[model samples]
Target chain A: MELGPYLILASLEGAVTAAVLALTAVGLSLVFGVMRVVNIAHGEFFMLGAVIAWWIAHSMGGHPALGFAVALVVAPLVVGAIAVAADMTILKRLDYDPERTIVATIGLLYIIQQLTLMTYGPEARPVEAPFNTRLAIPWFENGENGWQMIWPWGLGTTSYKLAVIGAAMTVLLGVWVLMKRTRIGLVMRATQTDREMALAFGIPVERIYALVFGLGAALAALAAVLIVPIQQAHYLMGGDPLLLSFIVVIIGGLGSLPGTVLAAILIGLSDGIISVFFSPTLAKILATLLVGLVLVFKPGGLTGSSGK
Target chain B: MSAKAKIIALHGGLLVLLFALQFVLPAYHHGNLARIMVLASYAIGYNILFGYTGLLSLGHALFFAAGMYGMGLGIQHLGLSVAPALLAGIAAGAVVSAALALLALRTVGVAFMIVTLMFAQAGYLTVLYFGEYTRGDEGFVIQQAQRMLWGIDLSDATNRYFAALILFATCLAVSLWLVRHPFGKTLVAIRENEERVRMLGYDIFVHKLVAMIVSGTLSAAAGAAYGLLFGYAGASFASVQYSIFPLLWVLLGGAGTILGPFIGTLFMFYLIDLSSGLTSAYMLIAGVVLVLLTLFAPQGLVGELRNRIWRWLP
Candidate 1:
């Protein structure tokens, strides 16, 4: 109703986008960081997460929370397993050659997409959020009787939306701690720093790579699961996330997790605000153009060393 | 005595066979053959950059779409005759590619690829954004009047096939010459090792930029010819799928070889045409083939054959 309420609503929406985008982009960045291979099928992994969540939720046919809980755990696990299998079968065999891997992943994208289209039946299915408590937001109004607080009509949000943001932050914190403090994290960091040295030190680089690939995919899946309740799951829903995540990864610098998160927020918030205020097309154009500029002027991104 | 003469004779024989096939093959399939030839030209164009120069662009669709839409729209909107309109379309492709290359060629490896992919996607988005003028997804058509060139009607099916054949032959000859030329070898050298090429006192940037322009212009001409021959131009022409298709063809047939693109185009086109009848999951086959090809046979059918069966053959 008022400028304050509208801005708040837009930011809230933007926050949700940023939360999910951060998770997905972070996964992409991590994969790049360790493997040094751009997973073109990363978005497909996101789509798989959403679709599997839908399938699991739908087939369970019980309390929405129970289905959601199951999906939240299962989607990421299944997607992660798939990624490991793909990495071993396809990527490993190729020895992770940059160009070939891209083509292979492009093929993987097609295979996954087509399989989903065939089995999933090309329908955009919606999943009910575990909890959707509607809370009306109050707005301050300059009434004749001094400043007054009024519950604005339609100026409300679902509790699930807030939960998404909180849950994502929690997971992100968990990831940070795991990367910073854990033995596996050290191994991964070692692998990222020097694959040859990591191997020489008996780190089992191949196994770590498989695990990292799976972990990266799982993160993307988790994000998809988080957002699927708000946005319907569809077979062809991978392209936008893929492109946006690429932009995020590029802007954040390809291997920097913190950079990915930051760029995600920057892109997500702007995307949300711009789309709400103006046009989605304009938002896309701006993001793409920004990526081009970043590529030309700052290819290393905001956080990482000059890669190119 | 040399590989040059051998290649020339090989091409000459294939050209005769193709010409003879025109009569022996049924008339109903002429249009399909024509379509194959136009697409083959694109593969050849793609091969110059990817096969010869080792630049794998995901944005070749910009040039392809430029040619298709430029030619179709030029004739439709400008009311220009066929030849001039085709030239204009080709010029547009070269210009767009050169512009993109100026920016993209600065980066090498994966960055170059993703950059090109983004640009191609941007072009597709631009087409959609200006949907009113470009007709967006619905596509556009060339008028019959504009299809006439110097009293000869390009709208005629036979004429269209011959025109496409001529274009294919021209591209093939030019490609054959280029590959044999020292300039083409330089591109190959750059592909093998850019640093070495640079250290040899060569201007790699200029060479790469020129490769992009030449390859892009040919693709554009092929795109325009496809639109002119079919009398249709659509948004799909500007899509990433189109870009990938040419790459697939070039790779599948043989990337650097003159006959590779032709064989790849023919094989892939036929496979697709055949498979599209049986199932909608036909693209899965392509994806699998691409994966297998990339892993096992990066050189493609012709390249593999040349390596194994006949080193002297083109």
Candidate 2:
């Protein structure tokens, strides 16, 4: 059995897996950095994004490509607004107590999930693949072409997956620039590191908190838009990603961008590879056990603070 | 009235009311009442960790599931009698819990909470993956719980209700003992100030592991009984939604108080039962109620009631 084309297919699949997780984990890490709340409703925001994008693409009449673009950019902002409202109304009042915040977010998660169930019903809805086309690379085909590559560049292609990867890379680089070289970003970092000192210096820490939460929500929503093509839009979809994102965040280290990215890719690729070889159920068990073992031995995670 | 006498009277009144309800209500309601009591026992265990000890475990259902699966495995496949099966379930819960605590107790706060949740999902999936032993997601049904002793005729509703009542009472007794004990006091101290407790030379890890294991064991008993009561056990028992119930119960009743989880359990179950009868979306109501309770009555029903009564009497 020839394994060359199959290996390329595997890598592409793995890359898509890594990108989706990293996209979602980045938003979670950002939210944790400023607010310190785990945002249990984080997955719902992603769900909303997927649902909205699906609806828009189905309704836009002719070209689905434009619909995909609109979803990548607009859905996130819409979801971000929801996140801002939640942050302003619930989290803002909780005063950043981890317990209360966790409970409150969990409560919010249920509300959102139930609402989504009410709105979408119990069935999983498939989003239209904006471009329904595939290019087959001639590996060991008819004698004329020897391992010749087809058009659309490489062997296999899913426009949706490619779009997702491109969006994730753009988001990561954009966020890095925003965090590393912006006036408000400087104040936000200062506030996270030393809230009292920043407050003493007249920084509007409250506004920063709200903005950061909204930004994280938008990022999660963006990921949701990308994920829908691969996994479809469904109410229960949030449950899997929510658990996976938590694992990624823990593996990456709370509030560390580099750590989150590296951890997300590592976890996502491993999870993908395992799922390819075994049942998704076994993969989840193995991944979680690994995380649990790591916590037992190295509670700080790959790059987390060893404050204790 | 003296506070001790009042407290005793209040508990007595509740017990009497619950017993009376079994007679006054229909058979189904009696079963539900039994279930409420059974579930309350589980919640009481959760309160030990979340309420009194100030630790949040988002995956408490692992213990519940362990007990449930144990009972299912014992009766259906292993051919153990009901009493032995239930004991086996509790033992299973204890073992799994000890293993989980070894890893989970290492982290604290949000790390502990999320990691515990991850493990809970892992536990659920592991059971699902080992479809051979666990029957995969299809689940298994126990024939019936055997008589507690030789020739007791354990099939009647009255016997079941009494059994549940006895178990609930035992759980309450154990909870009370735990809270009042010196070890319980240390748990509270750990909650208040882990750093100071550490400075005082107490091994916080050991204390947390003990609390977690005991909590898991009691919850497992409830889960085992619940499986027998329902006559079925499935992976859903270990899901995060199941984990939420105990936390909700403790909070609704008034965490850090002896009567909190009991009251919370009763209110939540009845509210859901009644609400489900009214609309299909009972979960929505429960979700809303939990949020409102957390926002407005963070101290819970018992706490709020006590404050009101104190104000009125004075």
Candidate 3:
């Protein structure tokens, strides 16, 4: 591969990876903001989303985009509704005991994983890319010399992958605007910052928590829908990304949107570059260690307290 | 002297029974029994920090790993005999615990748990990264017989079981003693109210750090025993899942009590084994049980059962 074409490919990969990571990190941050419970099962929601999308595609005669679109909407609702139910039933009883809640959610994670195993079996389900045409640019071509990069950059993704990335960015932007500019967003921020004060100010803190948690679940589902194309759907795929996204949230500063975004991109790029240079497993180790170093040196995180 | 006499009598009776069982039981079952004893011992180490001190470290596996690897490394690299190898593992575990305690003790509550977890993961990754030296996931074997004192070789399953039982009983007694001591009282004070403990002139951080190091050291000793029994050491020894097993054992048995973790580990493993035998959906069943336990009885099986029994009696 020529340097220019490789650079373009690398950048595109960076963009897609960053988008997926940002989507993952945001949901975790949101839930932490509202409920004070770090939902260890959040990655299961992401995994379930991918599984749901794959199932939809399989059932709908292999229209992956339709599957993607369906998952984008339905996956989050299904997972969020389950989480909402959990919130109302088990988590609600725990109140704000984050430790007990952590234990409970870990138990939930295993339950979901085992259920997935029973339902889907232990095999990884392969997901086909919905769209197949690469956006190609005319380059210098020779039979013996092989094709070479020339001038104008030709960026390409199947219309499906492009659509997924586009949709994800739109959802993220919409969430940012919603949190920054809306009335409920204001309440969420206020509650996340201080629940007692918010309650004293006449806010229905319980409802806000449930809503925020549901919203976070939806975001994770969105990520799962988009991410299905990159990796096969599997019951245990959630474990790795769950650990990685947690590192992202911690390094990005807890509940800081901009920080999460920046940290996500940083982690995404590092993961991609490291995987390319070394083994994928080593990349994971490096990425985590980098986060730990940041944590030990700067406990407040990179962007340090984006308000609450 | 009377209390000491009672302890000696009880200890002698237990040793006599253990010796008798060795002759009656099949050799393999005795080995299996030894394995369970080692695991229960490991759980006890976990309970020392989690149950009594109220520190929820999700990375106790690190100490265990340290012990296992310390023995493996000592045997492989230093050509050390069994007793020295085990001692090396204990020493390594102590060093790791002391180092980790310094950073982890700075934070309290859930943050401390997360930090410890991160460190454990980091430790796992670090080991996996140096795959060449640590044999990575392939694991290393300790080929030597553990050192014998006088003429008693500990490599034999029955002898190992007796050694493990003795070590376990000794550690358990020490832990119980520590819990009753002035220092133990200070830890309880810190657990109940750290701010008040600080007000009363006790350095909460120092006490917590000490407790963590001591607990980790015992966990390390158990890890060494685990390595000796299994004869292999791998990264799985330091896995996140291994960390959770002890945490669950403590949670299910009840924290802040002697004999809780031992009972909890035995019950949990047996419940799991039985469930697996009954159906493949055992994990789901176990998960449900775990969730129910957390939601309904935070005090755990023993603690909850004791309360109910007391109520009935009253």
Candidate 4:
């Protein structure tokens, strides 16, 4: 009812958007970081994850949570494998020439999107969340009782939405640790820093590329699986994620993970708040405009290093 | 035959074929031919930038759409004739694209592509934002009263066909001239190596800027003609799909070659048209063709032909 409570609600909603968007965008940023390739099909992989989640959940015929959990584990791996295959077949064959690969990935995007369209049909399908509990949020009111806690009417949120935020953060943390602490991450870093030297150092550079590409797709798929319950799965759902991912990646600086997460939160939070208060179309228009301006003014991104 | 003579013969033969076909073909078939001509012209404009200049822009749809809307609105609101409306559309497209190119060309490689894509998308939203006038996703049709152009009824299918043919021919000839010109050679050189061109003291930015404006203007002009002839222009015309259409056409036909866009457009249009009724997997063909072409045949049909036989095409 009050402005404070409404703003808080909007931020909470925005956090959910940021959480999913970070996972998707961080993947895009990471792929560009290591592979030097903008994986245009990245969003299609996200779309695939949602579609797969729906299929697995629908077919399992078990408790919704069980299906969701199984999907959580299965979707990313499946999507990751697909990405690896694409990297090998399409990207490697092109020798990863930056321009050629963009076209190749565009081809990949259409291939994956059309395949899903043919198999999944044109309709949007809802995925039942494992748990659906409405938790009413209380807002503090200064009354005779002195700062009494009052349950805000119609301001309750589902438990599942909150879980998505927690889950995405946890996954993002895991990714951070995996990248910083793991040996595989070191190899990827080495390759990014200098590919020929990495190869000379006995690191299987090509193999690491496969892993990184797969990792990017897996993250996108994981984000998709997480949000499919909130938003229905559709064949044509990849476009927005792709567009938003580009916007985030550009504004955050292409290869900077921290910058990406920060930018995602910035964009996702604003998008949610704006969509809630204003029109979604306006939100999209502003976001796209912001990206164009950022690209023109700050070619390296807001926090990204220069000379990119 | 001399390469120049061969080129002229090819152009002359194609022009005659198009002119003669409209009379024999049914009205529906004639309309399809007009679409091919206009879209091929669009692809030619795209080829000038991507094929000749070595810039791969994914945002040409914004320019194309600007033309469509500019012409539609000019005729409706400004009460202009078709010729001036088309010019207004071309000017709108050229200005918008030139401004956008100035900003987008600051970044190279993937950044440039993304910037263009974002700007095009922004343009699409802007069109939607003014949905009242545009009808947004529903699109706007040119409802202006048809007038005579040189004593010919403009609304007649035959007249529209001839007009489109003339537009396509002019664009093709201009593009041929540009590609053969020393200025066009500098673009090819830049595409080959920007650093070397820079070392040679040529202004790469100015050349690229001009190339982009020319490309955008041509695409936009074709778009204006398309809208006027088809009698409608919608937000979809300004969409990513239209942008990709030109890329696909140029890639499949031949990027640098003058007739590559035309060949690619005809081949693709027929393939998609024939396959659309048979299967829902029409786009799959396009995707596969693009992937295969990028991987195996980067030179395209005309480029490949030049690589082997038909060396006189230029």
Candidate 5:
């Protein structure tokens, strides 16, 4: 009811959004940094993840937790395999030329979206959360009682939402470790730095590219799976994530993981907070224009990295 | 025949063929042809920037929508006649493109694409936000009474066909003239090597800006003409799908070729139309075609024809 509690509620929602966005944007940033190609179908991979999660959860005759657990592991792997197949079949043939990659991925986007529309149908379907318990949040008020903690009505979140945030953080941390402390990451980074040099050093650059593309797509799928319970799985749901991820990648200074995460949080939070003051559509319009202006004025992005 | 005479004869012959087809074709195909010509005009406009100037914008739909709304709003709100509303639509496109070019030109490559896409997204949202005027996604129709143009009943099938043809021909001629002119050649040269063009004492920014304006204005004209001819103006035309349509058409038809847009539009329209009859997932066909084209026929149909047979195809 009060401003403090409402702000807290919005922030919590924003945190969930930021968590998902960070994963998606980080996935995009990784692909862009390593491959120097934008995967326009990244969002479709996310949509596929959600749709597959729904299918898995729906088909498995067991407890919701069991189905969710299976979906959590399976969806990303399936999406990753698809990404690898696409990379090998299409992007590899094009030699990862920037313009051609864009067009090709756009085609991939259409195929994936249309196929989903055909099979999934054009309806939004919800995935039952593994466990959902509404936990009321306590707010402090400086009253006659002096800093009394009071339970506010409608100031609560589902246990599943909190778990999503925690899950995203753990996954993001795992990704960071994989990139920083693994040999495979070293090979990928080396390839990213100099493809010809990596080839000369016997890095098996093409395989590394395939692996990286798959890994990036897997990360996006993972995010989708995590969020699918809270947000319904829909055929057209990928557009927002795709646009938001694109904005985060650009604002975070293409390829910078830290920048991507930070930008995602900022954008995600602002999106939630802005909706409190303005119509959701107006907020979106403002955000889109803001991103355009940022790109126009600061091509290098806020992190001061030369994207080129 | 001389190359010059041959080029003229080829374009002239194509226009004549289109005109003659109106007389003999059935009503369904005839209507589809008229629609194709207008969309082809949009693709031609896209080609000016993408095929010729090497600037791949992902937001031509903004200009297209601007034109449609500009004309539609003028007639709906201000009660302006068809001709002035059409001019108003073109003017709106010019102004919007000029402003966008100034900002968007600062970025190059992928950033440029993203910028235009973002602006277009904003434009689309803006249209939805002002739903009272635009009628949002469910778009309003322009009545037959409002569809008259200077004593000509443009709502009539024959007149609509001729109007679309005239629009398509004007766009084709404009593109033809541009390619032949020094200015258009400079744009082509810039596409090949921006650095070299700049070294040759050309103002690269101004050239790109002008190309963007011309491309945008033509697309807007197509949008305006589409709304006028079809008797509808909708937010769907301003959407990302609409933006991608021109790109797909230009790519399929042969990006830089003069006749590529028409062929692409015609081919794609029929492909979707026929496929939709069999299954609802007709876009799957479009997706497959795009991927296959990128893989096997990167040069597109007209581009392949030029490479194989007609070196002077432009």
Candidate 6:
């Protein structure tokens, strides 16, 4: 009821959003950085992940946890395979020209969306969380009882939400390790730095690109799978994630992975917090305008990295 | 025939054909053609910046919506007549585009696209936020009584067709004149090589700004005219889908070609119209066409024609 508890509640909501956004934006950042091409269908991959998770969870005749576990592993792989196919078939043929890639990805976005609408049938479907236990959060206040912890009504979150945050962090850490401590990452980075040089070094640049594209899409799908329980899977649900992650990727200085995560958190938190004080639509308008102004004034982004 | 005479004849003949089609066509196709001509005008406006000047804006819908609302609001709230309301719509578009150009022009390439997209997104949200006035997505319709231009009742089918034709022809002629003029050549040259154009003592920023304004104004005129002719103003016209529509039309028709927008609009309109008769998933066809075009016919229908048969095609 009090402002402090309400703020805490909003922050908790914000954390969940930030967790999902970081994954999605990081995925976009990776593709944008490495391939130097914007994948407009990135959000479609996210939607596909959510939809596939729903399908798997719905079809599997088992405990919700078992279905969720299977979906967690399967959705990303399926989406990743699709991404690789698309990359090989379309983007590769175009030689990854920036403008053409954008146009092609837009076409991919339409196809993916239309197919989903056809099969998914334009309804929002919810995936049952593996587990949900409302845990009340304690708040401290300086009252007559002096620095006492008190349980506040409606100041709680589901166990599943907390697990999502934890899962996202673990996956993000894994991605960081893969990028920094793996030979594949080295080859990818080398290709990103200089394609011709990477080719000279026998890096098999095209295969690396395919791998990177798949990985990026897999990351987006993973985020969608994690969030699908909290948010329903729908055909049109991809648009917001696409726009928000796009803003995050740009604000995070394009290909900088850390910057993408940081920007995602910043945007995600602000979006939640702003909704508390203003109409949600107004908050969206302000955020969109803010991103436009930022791009206008600081095209290099807040991290000051002129992304290649 | 001389090349100049041939170019004139081609454009003139197309306009004449469009004008004559109104007499013999059935009602359904006739109405679709009128709507197509208005949308083609929007695409032509889009081409001025994208095809000719190499500035690919993802937010032309903002200008289009601005005009629609500008005219709609003027009539609804301010009680202005049709002609003044139309001018008001165009003015709104000019101002909005000018302001957006100032901010958006600072960024180039992908950044520019993102900026325009963001602003347009914001514009769409703003429309939703102010739902009391603009009616948001549900939209408000202009009354038939107000849909009169001078002594002519524009609500009549024949008058509407002629009005659309007049608008389309004006846009076409303007486009034709711009392309033939040195200013239009400069825009084409800038599209080819911005650095070289700048080196040749041209103020690239001003040129781009002007192109943006002209493009925005024309799009707004279409939006205004659409609301007036069709008797409705809706937020959907200001949406991302609307922004992409012009891009798709220009791309499919042949960007930078004078007649490309009309051909693209006509082809796309019919493609959707005819296909929607069979199935509701016409967008699937649209998606496939876009991908196939990028793969095989990157130059588009008119572009291919120009490359293969009409080297003198504008």
* Global CA lDDT computed for model 4: 0.90
Off by over 4 Å in 5: A142-147, A306-308
Measured against the true structure, the TM-scores of the candidates, in listed sequence, are 0.97, 0.93, 0.90, 0.97, 0.99, 0.98
In order, the candidates keep a fraction of the true contacts of 0.41, 0.53, 0.41, 0.74, 0.80, 0.72
State the iRMSD of every prediction, in order shown. Answer: 1.2, 1.7, 2.2, 1.1, 1.1, 1.2
lDDT of 1 by residue, B179-293 (tens): 7789998999999999999999999999999999999999999999999888888898888889899889988998888899999999988888888888787787788888888
Can you write out model 6's per-residue Cα lDDT over B132-201, one digit (the tens) per residue? 9999999999999998889899889999999999999989988899989999999999999999999999
Q: Look at candidate 4 and tell me the lDDT of residue A277.
A: 78
**Residue A212 local lDDT, model 5:** 92
What value does the lDDT take at residue B154 in candidate 5? 87
- Models ranked on lDDT: 5, 6, 4, 1, 2, 3
The residue ranges of model 3 lying beyond 4 angstroms of the native Cα positions read A1-8, A136-161, A305-308, B1-29, B144-155, B278-286, B305-314
Candidate 2 per-residue C-alpha lDDT over A198-304 given as tens digits, one digit per residue, 9 for 90 to 100: 99999988888889989988888888887777788887677777777877887787788989899888887777566757777777788887777666666677788
lDDT score, candidate 1, position B130: 77
Best by lDDT: 5
Residue B238 deviation, candidate 4, in Å? Answer: 1.0
- Residue clash pairs of candidate 1: none
Residue-wise C-alpha lDDT for candidate 4, range B46-114, written one tens digit per residue: 999999998999999999999988888888777888778888999999999899989988988778888
Tens digits of lDDT, candidate 3, B1-314: 46556545654565566567777879876776666667777787888788777888888988989988888778777888777888999998899999888877766665677778888888888778877768888888765354454467667676778877776776767776787689987887777887888998888878888898888888888898788766788988888878888877777887776666766776887787778886675667656766887898888876776577532210
Better of 1 and 3 by TM-score: 1
lDDT string for model 1 (A1-308, tens) is 87889888888889999999999999998999999989999999999999999999999998999999999999999999999999999999999888989989988988898888878877899999999999888999999999999998878888999999999999999989989999999999999999999989999999999999999999999999999999999998999999999999999998988889999998888887788777676567667767766786678986777656
Tell me the spans in candidate 6 whose CA falls farther than 4 Å from its real position.
A141-148, A306-308
lDDT of 6 by residue, A204-269 (tens): 989999999999999999999999999999998899999999889878887888889899899988
TM-score of chain A considered alone, across all candidate predictions: 0.97, 0.90, 0.89, 0.97, 0.97, 0.97
DockQ of each: 0.64, 0.59, 0.49, 0.78, 0.80, 0.77
Alpha-carbon RMSD, each predicted model: 1.4, 3.0, 3.9, 1.6, 1.1, 1.2
Better of 1 and 5 by TM-score: 5
lDDT of 3 by residue, A54-158 (tens): 787788774666766666678888888877877777788888588888888888888888898889877788767666566654446455668765545554545
